[model samples]
Target chain A: MTTTSTKGQRLPQTSKRSAKAAASDKRPDEDASAGARRRQIMQEAARLFGTRGFEATTIRDIAAATGILGGSIYYHFASKEDIFVAVHGAGMEKITQAVLAAIEGVEDPWDRLEAAAVAHCNDLLGSSEVPVIVSPYYSESLKGLRETLVAQRDRYETVVADLVEALDLPPDVDRSLFRLNFLGALNWMPTWYRPSARLSPADIGRQLVQGLRPR
Target chain B: MTTTSTKGQRLPQTSKRSAKAAASDKRPDEDASAGARRRQIMQEAARLFGTRGFEATTIRDIAAATGILGGSIYYHFASKEDIFVAVHGAGMEKITQAVLAAIEGVEDPWDRLEAAAVAHCNDLLGSSEVPVIVSPYYSESLKGLRETLVAQRDRYETVVADLVEALDLPPDVDRSLFRLNFLGALNWMPTWYRPSARLSPADIGRQLVQGLRPR
Candidate 1:
């Protein structure tokens, strides 16, 4: 498990398709500014998706929020779905990095899980933009996009799964369900978490792990 | 706590406005079939909302699904949002009823909570239509409807809260977060749960509770 742990590791891996697309089909003028503009579009689109949901949000809305003309957005991404994929990918990267950094020096398995949880909670509940879009409710209409989002999400999930596998639990415990329930608790926080709440994200994360820790 | 238990007690309370409108504004001819037609609209709309999301789904889709003309849907609902409210209200009533019945005569607080969780899991993950719509990802655009949905959701939440309050846990436990985490785990199931999974809904519910039960 320690060998597999993502601690102190800089994971530069993006999804293969996106990498290939960037290499082959992207415009020749791609530069630092173009990269920044793409990020800007994703950030603005993430905000809208968080507020209005994927379907209700439009390319026009993203362009307007980013202060670019709607047609200009097509220059960066093929469609709204493409923008969503980018935002989702960015969000997954953000949280995955957060979790990896938090668990870097933690040796104990349960403690590592707790650290990851704290980092996850902070990233998810601390901000209103990227993480929210990362876990948007997957309605059937988004079926075509769901596979891509879930695959991206699974990269982060594998880190958590490895941590759960390292825990010293009773043989009867189902580790898969354990990991799912642990994540469900953390991910579900945004629905009820308030910034003013006395429990900071770290506190919430610790409490969650404490509740589930084997006696 | 049992005194406040909703067990065996029928909760007929719907939101005030809906009840009032159902009485005053509804036509006198709202006979058995009219009531059935209204339910049909809600069921179809719930399915669409589950598959297509609230923003993407339209009255036309609901009408088409219900085998009624789009304009005639106005007779059953004033707007798509109205249909959403109806479906959500109906879903709340459904899970509430399932939970209330489940905890009935279960005396131990933990056992009662487990019972409620089992019932909740069954209802939420068992079917595709109602419970799915009940917890739609609330975006900023849905701010006007959030209060109503949250209020309706709270009626069921109170039951869980009361159950949590009855638990004999460490003094340090934040019961509010405890309840939130517990409900979050259960509610998040629909995102990843598959009917083919080896764990039955009952098994999943029991497992969730067992994981949290204090040693």
Candidate 2:
């Protein structure tokens, strides 16, 4: 019933396996500029990964996209998996912050849920990174990255869990199932949504609430 | 906002590029047994494609899995993409039949929608093939298969469109968006649903109704 309400298997709670090169391991001079540069690298890498998929995409491809040399790209991260991990983290952070901001100060649980759904759909539609984190379709092929991604997902789902907990529903309703179904719909948006389409993300979000809300 | 509600780009409506070997072109001798063999091949291929991606899965892998030699696979399927299209067709047929059967006697829009939703979730959770057609996450890389797949998707979405069309809702409610959100949630079950979990497909389906139904 938790965010980990998965079919028997799930992502790791905490993977100590370092996907990144430590400051002590590779760079002793890591600082604010380094952090910002890492963010920039992650943004482009996430986009390419989303577009090209995991296997077809290469570190060299990411480097070219970022206008940096392939070898230099590794200086920011240990490997392709490392960059993916960072992208995963960045995508989760972006969507999470957006959802959190949307739901803030909304007293009604349904309203908050709708707002969260809207923010989520809008973010996924607007940002490639959010969809990357949401689907992780490519990650299935990358076994080493699975645990790290799952751990990050658990963090993201906790935010959703809190929102679901706020809903005032019948005592008999299964809250876990509610959240699962709710999120499945929310996450599946990237596959079908279009800006040219009639429904905006917010409109779609509200309709979800209307469709699900008891008549 | 119909089933073709895609993100700017989508598959072709009618691909004159036939995936199947035409009667005059190659398989003129195809009989009932050949038809059964094609079905068997598609079932096994769909499962393999679902587990390993289309790119990673080879024709030989499918042939071995089906207990046939690699060369024999082509007797029924022209290529891997051909097998994929057939699987897509079969998966669609199975779910469509199940959903059509479930909603046959149902009349009320709310009840019919719930029936369709339950049938869909059950179909998805019960059959590995259903999820194959539903997500086809690997299709992103197969540029040639994209249009064909999208066309198949349009067919599937039509069923959903019919169900949404029957719904009695407010004028302000965007029916297309409602169904899109509803379907998004329904289609996402396979990623997390476990038989060992508490909710049965029908139970989960009912919960979707309860969550979405107006209070």
- Give the top-scoring candidate (TM-score): 1
Against the true structure, candidate 1 reaches a TM-score of: 0.85
> lDDT values of the candidates?
0.78, 0.70
Per residue, candidate 1 scores C-alpha lDDT tens digits across B1-215 of: 11122223322332223433455544745544556677778888877776666777777778789998676766555667777778887888889889999999999999998999999999988864555454435756467988898998999999899999999888989999999999889887888888999999999999899888886
Q: Candidate 1 falls in which docking quality class?
A: acceptable
For candidate 2, give the DockQ: 0.39
Model 1 lDDT, residue A2, Cα: 15
For model 1, how does the per-residue alpha-carbon lDDT over A14-61 read when each residue is reduced to its tens digit? 222343344454474564455567778888988877666778788788
My TM-score estimates for the predictions, one after another, are: 0.85, 0.79
Expressed as tens digits, the lDDT of each residue in A1-215 for candidate 2 is 11212223322321222323332345546544455566667777777665555655677777778787666665566667877877787678778888899988998888888898888878877645324455524444677677778787787799999888877778988878888878887787777777888778788777777666655
Native interface contacts retained, candidate 2: 0.53
Give the candidate number with the greatest DockQ.
Answer: 1
RMSD of 2: 9.6
True-structure RMSD, every candidate: 10.6, 9.6
Clashes of each: 1, 15
